[model samples]
Target: MSKEIRNDSECSKTDDKDWHQVTSIEQIEAAIKKEFSDESDSRKTVTAEVKNDKANWKIVLKKKNEKAEENFASEAKSLKDKIYHSRFMTTIRAQKAERFLAGAAVVLVLVVALVSVSVSTCYEVLVDGENVCYISSASELDAALKDLKAQADANTNADMTEAVLSTDVEVAAKHKVFVETASESELAEILQEKVSWQVPGAKIVVNNGESVLAFATLTDAQSVLDTLTQNAIAANSGAKVLDTRFYEDVTAEEGNVDAEDILTPEQALAQIAEGKEEVKTHTVVSGESLWSIASDNGTSVSTLNELNPGLREDRIQIGQEIKLNKIEPLINVVVDKVVTVSEAIPYGETVKESSKLMKGETQVVTKGVEGSKDVTYQISEYNGTTLEKVTLSEVVTKEPVNKVVNKGTATVATSSRSSSGSSSGVFSWPSKGTISSPYGKRGRGFHTGIDIANKKGTPVSAAAGGKVTSAGWSGGYGYCIIVDHGNGMKTRYAHLSKILVSVGDSVSRGEKIGEVGSTGNSTGPHLHFEVIVNGSTKNPINYLK
Candidate 1:
């Protein structure tokens, strides 16, 4: 019996050693299972002592009641299940929190995008710090201002150097939820009515300190004066100019003026040269002459002649409209000059007694010749008209030759009497009439011949025995006849109704040539007679006998 008891104690020692060798939880569980399977002793108990660290563990075996051991195993399995459930729940909660944060960020971005789309930005225009209008864009406002300025410049008559706005204007950007913007046209219209434009100009002031004309600049005003002075100098082209100046004290004053009041240089010059005069007209009454009309209108006959060209003093009708504007220059240009001219010296006549011809007959011995002399005169003119003239000196260049003629002293028989009547002296009267118009200066023109009034179809005769040089129609002198006598002497009889003589015919003194009539610029039946010597016309009275 003693040997058996010692063997059982040794077996117990081996089991304790096996329990200390277990390192893993599986091995510990397997050992516990094996110990529990052996139900030979129901009171046998197994106890395990676990260390506090994961790397090292110690299990201590002890005997205990079967119910207590079963209860500890159940409790250990429940603790392990609780620990796994706690770790899984912690991981799930962290993932859900991360998704929630991402969703919130997306919603915030959408909200901000919607608000930005509704609100917009625009530009506001202000004048004098007062809001005038709103525009959609800044560029549109700029374009509108430019167009308004150009329109203002175009409306002005004078040149606009620069366009200035009377009020201060500005543009600024503004942010708004709702804004009413103006169109381009509307913006321009508003600005035009609200803004005032100012321009710089100049005025032309006369001696009386009154402004006669206005111009865009001072240079334009000066140009008008310079042109007026230049025209005065140019009038006396060939004369030596002494001095030229304006008659009035003209000056330029700079200031602001109305744009419509400005005048061009050409217009100003015309106004200055032609003084302000309202032209008038006069209707001639019955039995009214040009002289009477001129006297009644506070004017002169010369002025009437100047106004109406081709007007005959003796040919005016009963109902003729005559222009009565006698223009007087606003400024007179006076010029003084010394001029030399050549003048003709008429030759004298000489008579000698001879017996070579019949009684009351004459024959030429020597032809006459004219002389020339240089005459200098001091002259002063106002507005191209002679105001004063004085003779300075006269020098004879060539001497004249007197004409010599032979007169018959013997008498002729009746049968041998010349058909050409006995010629008396050098010339005779061509026609019997009363002198109407004398040969001299007549109303702005020189009368080259004298007019003789008579009844129509009256007898006309040759003044001297000579050949007819010209006959038929002549300009201004109708149905004219010219007789060429010897020694550079000729005679003309105009306004004839009939011609009884032909060209190249040798006519004697008092020979019938033509009949008087009213023709070719003549108002009545008259004879326009002229005497010419050496291609120059002389006073007919001086040579007519």
Candidate 2:
């Protein structure tokens, strides 16, 4: 018998007696014999027929009243008709068609919901409305643009006050964009290649003029200015910052530099720390030569002689006002302070003859404690350096206990090479000179060491065998060296112009170690010598013999 079939058309099969047009013997046998149940109203029953005439097969999908499903069924049936007609094929199609229709209805609903949910399909990354590329999400495009801007700001070493790369996102249900996809890193590179970033910071101006320098912050520029003013004078004086201001102009510029690229405060101070060019006159004091006056006034001997052409550089008599050129401060920072401090009145030692002690042995019978004295001082400073300190009042607070020491009176084997015999203990004279100043009270301050005034280049020797503990420029002592004799004794050689030994070198007694000169605070060439026993300064005269 001949049979016909409808593709994607509804045909009811609710009852067992209900028949199909493809009920031929071969078609009936091709369908599976089973007890089928139709319980769902949403999923209707359908039949897929098999035609023996020329081996034609057709699938009829019976679906609910749904527009999208009907449209999909018509298109699917058209495709199947072209590929399956006149082909030898057989499939048990009743149960499959019912299940396929139910699944198709659910998928159709989901597709419709999805089409409404997103009017924009792919996230289209646009640069100035020109499509760059498409990303999966709008947030991904935003993240890429944000990363690009941050990197640009960091690369330029400044803040981006204005936007140079304009970026946005666009979405559409369908768009014909033919750009390649890029990752976040690649997107940053693409944006950077297309635009330049803006650099904006503060500029430091000096002396009421426009400055070309731009620092990271206003404080940075201000620091550079303040450093220049503070050191505008000589090494001993100071200056104050004045008329300082910050200039802030935010602009989009290229080829900008970082704040660290500019010179530091120390470097800026070195360039402008010399004060204004001026000459002054200073009256000559007793025992003052051109070199001595220049050293005291922060000038060179050549400058003093040049300022006064007729004045003799070799000899300048007292009461003669010599011309001196010294750098002064731009703004003086003078400090006048009154301070009260307790001074130590050192205990005097007493020596007693003892026969029990060996000839070269000694013993301390009593320990001494330092006495205190209250003193008031008036101090004056130029810049940060102290210029003068005057004692206003003094009062003794306690009387010190005298110390007693046993002395060895027996004759001991000893040798001396010094012409002036001051050595009586364990060392010899460090230099050949008269005692210009003793190790005692001198003027307002107690002298901690003895001063030996000699010629400009007198040789200074080590007082005893010891290792040099320190050797360098010392405060108020100029070029100095300290020798640790390893027996609770240390000797110091100060106010030398040149040092011949190093810090860790070993030397014997009377070994030449330096040359005498007025390098530190002194009126003439001299050697300041000190003897320390058990970390206390003692009379150097006792160690010289």
Candidate 3:
């Protein structure tokens, strides 16, 4: 047997008391496979050596060597297979482990980065060493600092400073509030910037965190406090707006400014006056006096009466002209000279040759001279009411002397009659009377017939022979007679006292037909005689034969 050597100390270390439990067979195999343990075990002897006779010994050695070789070869092959398999499995496990470790490391780094990015910092705002508000963003922190400084400069109270510093500030992902102090305006501005302002019809009606004044246009929405310093009305009232300054002096007098073209209260009132127009008219009513009508129409009674000259003030008729209330026109009276008279001079005769005079040729021997009567003019007085007469100059020329010439002819009241129903060629006055009113239109009515004033019971004679027709009371004619001469000629004597002829009675010229009397609506004793030819009344002066 080979010498078996072992360390007592090592053996004692492996005792039950020292090592109570074994980890695994793999652990034991590793320990036993160590170089030191393998060398020591290799040196251990097996006791009682095998026979070594020459042949027997050779055979035994050969057999043993063969078996040993077999065994060695098998053990080496098994060990080699185990080593290869185990090595491959171990390499795979190591690779998987490395991949897992790398992935875990990467996840840990991402987690650390994410945690760092989400973190924020806080800040406090100070106003003169006094805390105002807290913030968590850089931009907010800056704004807070500014607000705090302003508060300090202004010497604002704690409440006001705090109020000014409080803000709803927004933060970007990279930014955080770093201060506690922020003005209200600054905070509002920050919050406002985050929202979109491009919506249709959207009004950006806020400025510096304050609402802009509401108005139809910007020009109309200016702060009154800003204008108070310059506006006279505001100066008198002493008012301020938006915390603006107001310094008013009550001793200062109010100013007056005329705004004729402006759309203001006073201007509106003045416009009413400008739109007014003046008009005038006249109206006639019952029981209205001329004076009253004139007054109501803004005219004088005399002026109104002059337009209706026939009207009397005490005897006014309905539907008469009356003045109306209205504005009167400004009149400029101008007087101009006018000629109303004309004169003519006649040519008088003087012998131009003696032989012409011997022939007794009287050619207008007495050229009658013409004379002119004065034309009277009148000026109206009493608002052109009364007329004063003015006489125009009269013109006359001396009468020319006439030379006498004689021609022989028979003198008789009657001339020879012709075969045609002609007159004896003589004419005499039909009737004798004085004219009361001449032919024309008098005041208020037409004077259709002439008024011949005559004595009562005067003899009415026929101027020519004719047959008498029936006559009686007509509209305004009484005691009348109509005489029809044979040649479509007729005559009428109206308002007479008596009629001496009957119907179809023949009458001669110079025979009495009636007597003058006032009858049938006659105003006086007068004859209304008419001469009708071919069914028409002819003027008596034109046909008195």
Candidate 4:
């Protein structure tokens, strides 16, 4: 026992619910042990209540001694061991499953990564800054672009067309994920940028059916044609173009890159004019000239002239031959035009008679000469050949000279003149020189008689004994004389300066009739003689005997 404790309320009044008094220390220790008997509880505590409204409430526990700590640690270790032992097989199976799941997840991750890398490796094709298609191999993309370029080049051969064309294609590898491999055909379709132009265009023609050039559009072709025609017109006044044509032709190809071949207008025109050329021989007809022969043989007159330098326009004879080179163009550049030209005007003559001269004898007192005048003519021509001509105006540049003829009135003695038809069928040479110009074609016109060269005052002789019919000035053959013999025999002497016979006068054989001289249309002094029978002229050599 310790000591007794009393509350203030106890001194005032006693109550039946009073607290029990603590008697000894042994009792307190026993009570404490009983309260803390359970060892599983971590806390070992003791509680006390004090009386009335001012009761002291408190809870306290003793600190664990050495043995107590050891016991607690032992109990924890034992519980851990029991739990582990109870689920030993389950724990082992769970650990095995976890390992397997982790390994499978790592393998799946690796597979996914590999697939991603493979899908990312791809090729991209671009055309003119636009993404065209995707491919698997970089080589494939490059090959496709190359193939397109090759096709384009093949389509555009340099000679076939003019315009040069190309395609802009690019290829590159793109790193991507889950990209599908593109189909070859699909990729080609996507990559194709079909561009079209005149690669193999139609030809333009200039001369008749002659190819002139090639162009892309109809408009371009027409433009070339018009330009050529206009330029020719500008260079040559009144120029006419013949047989021009323009056409189109298409050579389209189904490919990525396309090219065209076009030609220049000049080249095409040259091609159309190709033809064969050769030399040929021709015989002159009765009326054929150099110009006509050239036109027939498709050659120029200059070429014919070169081949036959001796052929003359005015002196061409019958049955003459010539050589020429013939060149025929496939396309005939036949042009036509209208033009104006100038020509000469021949002068006229007037005859005046004088009574002082003899009746049959006539002399040219005044010599007549030609004059000049400008005659303007409107002419239509084809290829320089005159087709039509009309006189527009005529202007005289020089005046004409009029010829005057005098007739002598002197008469010969009757005894001197022999009887008409004195020697029958007898003839003599009319002039002294040999025959210079033969009958038929001579100068500008036909020569009706033979010409004999002699001096100016040479004696003229009669071909036969006959009576003089008449003697006077004659056209072309000035101062002409005609004689009539027995039956139908006659003789004529022309281009005489003096006449010895008159009308109704009889002349003997070998009698002089006139003197030779250059008269109207005569180039020089000569004698023109002819023999006639029954009003028909004959060669003088056959009659002279």
TM of each candidate vs. truth:
0.38, 0.24, 0.22, 0.31
- lDDT of every model, 2 decimals: 0.67, 0.58, 0.42, 0.53
Candidate number with the higher TM-score (1 or 3): 1
Q: Across residues 1-545, which tens digit of lDDT does each residue of candidate 1 receive?
A: 00001111122221444555554444444444433332223332333333222322223344344455654465445433332233222342445433433332211000000012233467889988989999989999778777866766677556566645666888898754235689888998888777665568787877666436778888888888777667766776765555655545667778776555677787777776676566699999998999899999989999889889999988899889999985655444555666678999999999998865434457889999999999888777666567778898999999999999987554322121235644223456788889889998989999888988899998999876667899999978989999877567778999999989888887766779999998788989999988877778777766565
Candidate 1 wrongly placed segments (more than 4 Å): 1-211, 247-258, 329-332, 336-382, 387-545
Clashes of each: 0, 5, 16, 16
Please say which candidate is ahead in TM-score: 1 or 4: 1
Off by over 4 Å in 4: 1-198, 206-340, 353-362, 402-414, 417-545
- List model 4 lDDT by residue over 69-168, tens digit each: 4444544343223322323223434455434333221110100111211223677776666776678897886565556555555654333234333546
| All candidates in order of lDDT, best leading | 1, 2, 4, 3
Better of 2 and 3 by TM-score: 2
lDDT-wise, the better of 2 and 3 is 2
Candidate 1: TM-score?
Answer: 0.38
